[model samples]
Target: MRRNAQALFGLVILLAGIAAVVATRDWKIQTAMYPRVVGIPLVILAAIEVVLSLRGAPEGERQAVDTALSETLPPDVTARRTRVAFTWIVGFFLAIVLIGFPAAVPLFMLAYLRGQGRESWALSLVLAGVAWLAFELIFDRVLHLPFAEGLLLQILRR
Candidate 1:
């Protein structure tokens, strides 16, 4: 029953992502980003989930229900972590909107690494800095991407 519910949920999300990609066809950036990157993975994952859910016990000589029921359920750590991570991620995006990507990206990365990865502070900060440098300097600056200017750009302009 739980597996069925999960499969159904995945199917819904998969369809929604596909619909979003289709609906945003007019926007070149969104179209390119969604169908190839997000949509494909969602569809593939949904399919795998559905397959797993549909596969049940073979013609049972003896049902394993007793054994399955006896086994302790795993901790809900993944679900809890997912919720927390998503909350922080949304907060990070909001910060980007107000503070700008240049500043927000590193802050978000560091927080995610430290809070989620449970890594040492020094390592998290160093990794975040490297990521910022790679993206801002190597990608945005060198490649000359017209990356969206955030609040940081306003300050830089002044």
Candidate 2:
């Protein structure tokens, strides 16, 4: 039953990826590149998963690839860790919404690396710099994608 459910989920993802790829047909190459890059792989991987799931791939095989922490950790510990993970995810989205991507990207990287990852400050700063540079060069310089200013920025400008 679980295997069948997995296959069904994979099929749904595969269909969504197909829809996204098809929808990008009228978009400019630069505008479509991100979606195409993501969607094409999504379709291929989901199809593969559907095939594997239908083939009765053993649960052990899948578990080896992505073992759940809940299986190993104490329930309380797992719950706490899950909450922390969700907090970081929610904080990331909040940062983006509040400060926009340009500022939020490096800021989030630095905070996550130093806070959660327990990396040295120097390493965090260097990694943040590299991430910021890559984001600027690819999205800003090459693609010329215009990220909308955050609500806070828009309000401040008025």
Model number with the top TM-score: 2
- The C-alpha RMSD in Å for every predicted model, in order, reads 9.9, 8.9
- Which residue pairs clash within candidate 2? none
lDDT of 1 by residue, 59-156 (tens): 34646456543224454766666678689878998888877777888988998899888999999999999989988987688988765668766787
Model 1 accuracy (lDDT, Cα)? 0.75
Give the winner by lDDT.
Answer: 2
Write the residue-wise lDDT of candidate 2 on 1-158 in tens digits. 76888899989989998999999999999999999999999999989989998998776745565645546877778879999999999998998898899999999999999999999999999999999999999999999999877779988999
TM per candidate comes to 0.48, 0.57
Provide the lDDT at 158 for model 2.
Answer: 92
- Model 2 scores worst on lDDT over the 10 consecutive residues at 61-70
